[model samples]
Target: MIERVKKYIRENHMLKAGDMVAAGVSGGADSIAMLHILKCIQHDMGFELEAVHIHHGIRGEEADRDESMVRKICEEWEIPFEVYHYPVPELAKEWKLGEEETGRIVRKQAFFRERERMGFPEQKTEDQPQFLVALAHNRNDLAETMLHHLARGTGLRGLAGIRPCGDGIIRPVLCLERREIVNYLKEKGISYITDSTNLSDEYTRNRIRHHVLPAMEKEINPRAVEHMAETARMLAAADHYLLEKGSRLLSGCERKDGYLFEGEFFREDQIIQEYAVLEAFGKLAGKRKDFTALHVEQVLSVSEKGIGRYIRLPQNLYAVRQYEGVHLGKTVPRKAPESTESLVKREKYPAEDFWEIPVPGSLECPFGIFEAKIFSYKKQKIEEKKCTKWFDYDKIKNSPCVRTRRQGDFLVVNREGGRKKLNRIFIDEKIPASLRDKIPVVAAGSEILWIPGGRMNEQYKITSTTGRVLELHYQGGVLA
Candidate 1:
């Protein structure tokens, strides 16, 4: 088993000489076996080894015992060790996430923190050795994950299950089965602590492990886990191939706002198109948490719709069909305001919902800091700039607030007090329909005082009768 793991690590290019490797040891058979194997091969492999243990804080005394056992093992072997404790249940509530997801997040945080403490560089270079975290996922774990994803309706990436290595982490014992890990530990007379939760079906993975996998092994095939692991590897290879080809095709589709998939993009095979859309969405979202195959299909469906048609997606993103191609971007603040009576009835606004501009002070908004100051009128030229504007302090009937456009939003179009709806101005300016919602406006009641990149209300223009000039400057918001 040790030799086989060594060969797998080498083949995967998981480590090199002088590399620092941290193995996650949970005091379970799988983790214990992996730690021992890596310890045995560290000198030959020319890498440094340490153990990291994470306590989920749900198992109480059992969890304490597990931590103690792992610490003792590392001490006896003279291996550097680190342990992190997290209240997963409490954190799950605080983060609005599941216990399982919370645990995974904290575990990753612990591993990355350990790497930083060990003085590993943030990025890897050709001349430098790597800093890797080793996980103890076995063939059975891979099979279980595949089954879980299948039950949840997964895509090719989900069907591929776990990889040998990714994102600065490696699974050195992924080739081994659960039974093999236990047999090896028993042969070596090593003891391990088991969590009581594993015996219950409270969790989906636990149910699969306790019932579904065992039934499949007994009735369907004795080597079901092994065969599933093999199948996952093949699927991973195919997924990788599609990802590379799709990425190459998407390379030229990059746009200032987002990727623009031209008509030529539709000529590719449908599978390749799906992969390319997946890649683009992932890049825009920064993470693919709730983005599933259904969302991918929605994005693809936009191609068949009219030019103005768009579909909302997770992470406040949208895919809109355009004359050139499909445009993907974030949803800007476009909610129109209610009637003026509704605005007057509201007593307060949450800081996140809207910002009340401070006279002679600065306030931060979606676009950036909006600084305002009131001074006696001076006989000087009002220099014009895209982000800066001036208004008559006394002519403003109400305190100005910075926010997105509202339903009755309108700007004074002439000295005669003629008004133009905000939407009409957007159209007259020929602003991209997708960008209309993102523009920030300063308003008093339902009347817009200033449009940062465009115009200020003509009613607020400074004149000989203007007693004070209210200067407003906007700093730092992306218009393009």
Candidate 2:
């Protein structure tokens, strides 16, 4: 078991030379065995080890006994020990969160505080291995998480279950089963406290452990826990691949206030699409504690409509579709960067303000005055790309107003008509941010019909089948 765990740690690259790892000891068989295993390998691995114990203030004297036992174990191992006492029940009420969530938060904060107190980590950045908080999630814990996620209706990420290392926490003992940990401790003559609450089926986790797991073992596969753990690892690898691919796709569609998701975002497989939306929410949300697969579905559903369509999410964040892209941002403007002046140029047309369009009529904006005329398809001789553009008039349902680009404006980039955020296009084309107001945009809803010299949205362009053609000619100022 020890050799298998050591192999798992090495395979995951959980530690490196000169690293400092903190083992979170709950005075239970799982954590105690993990601490011992880590201690056994630390010298050869050339890393330092310390132990941290959290007194959650729920089990009364049992909690104190747990802390004392961990302190004693740390002393015997000649390693530093840190203990934190957090009133998790009161804090849970105060924070309006469940006790389980509050306890997890408090424990994480204590671990971070301990890590900081231990002095500066030698390395920082993606390439270097992180100094981590070692957690005691065994194979059984992983199987329980998988079952929990499945019960809740989850995606690939949920199926992936508990990660070995993420956000500075490492579960080095996850490769071992709880029974294996208890047996290893017994073999080593080490005693651990068994939390009495664990014996009761009061909690959902306990019910799973005491009832569900035993039934599965007796009636189904005896190695069900190991099988589930193995499945989780495979799913985790697949999730990693999709995340990397989605990240690249996300970079193209993201904007300043939120992501301008469209085109590749929706064109990719559903797995990538779901991952992208989830990632976008994580980026925009202050705390990503409550988003779910349902939220992702809602976002995607609303994102396919015309401009101004939106779905409000938890924490006041929303995903809105405008023109060619979907934006994920707060429904209310952010407080800090509110001074950043936000998206869409606030420049008022010096010569004119925008008005709704009528077919074959003239409209005026600050940049220029444009004349629109519709003629029969046979009479069409399209000319002058600089000052004029032709569109299939019959295809345009609503009157596409000729004006400056608005807050949610987007442009279709290619002949295939994949959408790109207007701002994204400006940045991609190296159009000076200052030149945006000077650009004349003809748009209908979120869709941009023409950006004058830049592009005539491919979806609206005159095709050979065009029976009636609409010609737009700008007559005044810079665009002319």
Candidate 3:
């Protein structure tokens, strides 16, 4: 068992010398064996070892006893130990999350706290890398995960199962079966606490392990975990290829509106395009809920027409049809005018509109237009929330074109009262660099007049006796 773990670690380049490793001990045979083998390996591998025990506060006195046992073991081994004390039920309620997610969050918080307390922010020494959190997931757990995802009708990504290494976490004992861990614990004659809740068939995982796996072992092959693990590896490789191809295909289809797929793509092959769309859309919405085949079929059914339409999905996401395209995304509500039925015909514009010159007026950029305009106030009363603005036309240039920010743009901000580059303005506003190019800036020659959601140039302002009233309003393009 130890040899298998060692081989897996070596293959993954998981652990290295002088690394501060922490083990998540849940008072189980798998975790105990993990700690034992890790301690043995640390000496030869040249890494530091520590243990973390979390008291879920659900098991009453038994939980306290578990913590005490863990502390004693760590003290005997001369290793640093930490314990997280949290109210599980309260956390579950406040976050509107399940027991598993709450437990994970608090335990991670405690681990990082202990790590920082142990002089973190210290870079790796010449001998090794920094630190890593080690888990004790065995082969049976991996198999169970695959089965669970399959039961839930998950996508190909879920079939890849539990990863051995991801970011700061590593599972060195993932290659070993649960029985080997129990045997290892017996060989060492080490006594560890076990949660009584694990015996009860209340949890889904426990039920699967006790009832489902045992029945499978009786009727089917006993080496199910091994076979499943092998299948997972093959599926993971195939999943990688499909993901790459899907992503490449999606690159052309991806748009701000949403991703568009040709309906014929799903009919062609095993790599289902409908599943790909749901997966992609769910990711965009920051979720991975098991969107079923039924959901994909519904999305496909609506997109057969040429005109665009919106279809609400399981999550707070939408599937919309476009001109010769269909997309799934978050739908932004269209703003309608007072007594207006649709978005397009809501805003009333005059065919013949002209205004006399007046003082400077503040104008907000319309939905599609990025630049704010300054013109003479023509209308008597205008709502602050309205996209249109009336500015004093006489205070500024006679004719200025509304456009996006050009390179080498400069602005004299009112707040700072100094000339600064548009790039600097974007940085000061903390606008993500990727979005800076898309931001609209009103410009006259080399001077930037306005940056929406940011500072407006102080140079242009309403003055007294401005005759020409300039009505600055957004025209053409998509409404924001």
Checking candidate 1 for backbone clashes, the offending pairs are 336-406, 336-407, 337-406, 337-407
lDDT for model 2, on a 0 to 1 scale? 0.74
**Candidate 2: residue 77 lDDT (0-100):** 86
Give the CA lDDT, 0 to 100, for residue 45 in model 2: 88
Q: Could you tell me the lDDT of residue 91 within candidate 2? A: 83
Order of models, best TM-score first: 1, 2, 3
Off-target runs (Cα >4 Å) in candidate 1 are: 331-480
**Candidate 3, 1-480: lDDT as tens digits:** 667778898887787877788899887788888998898777878888899888888778888888888888888878778888999867776675456668889988887887788776645553556678899898889888888767644666678788788667899998888887888888889987777878976555777888888788778988887888888878877877886776655666676867766545445454546546655766677665435544566566556644645555545566666665666677643531211111121133332221221222222222232223232332223222233433455545644544455668888776456898988877886666655554454556667765533455665544454454444433222211
Top candidate, metric TM-score = 1
Residue lDDT tens for model 1, 160-239: 99999988889999999999999999999988878776877656687789899999999999999999998999999999
Give the alpha-carbon lDDT of every model: 0.80, 0.74, 0.65
Which numbered prediction scores highest in lDDT against the true structure? 1
What candidate 2 gets wrong by more than 4 Å, as runs, is 121-123, 126-130, 331-480
TM-score of 1: 0.69
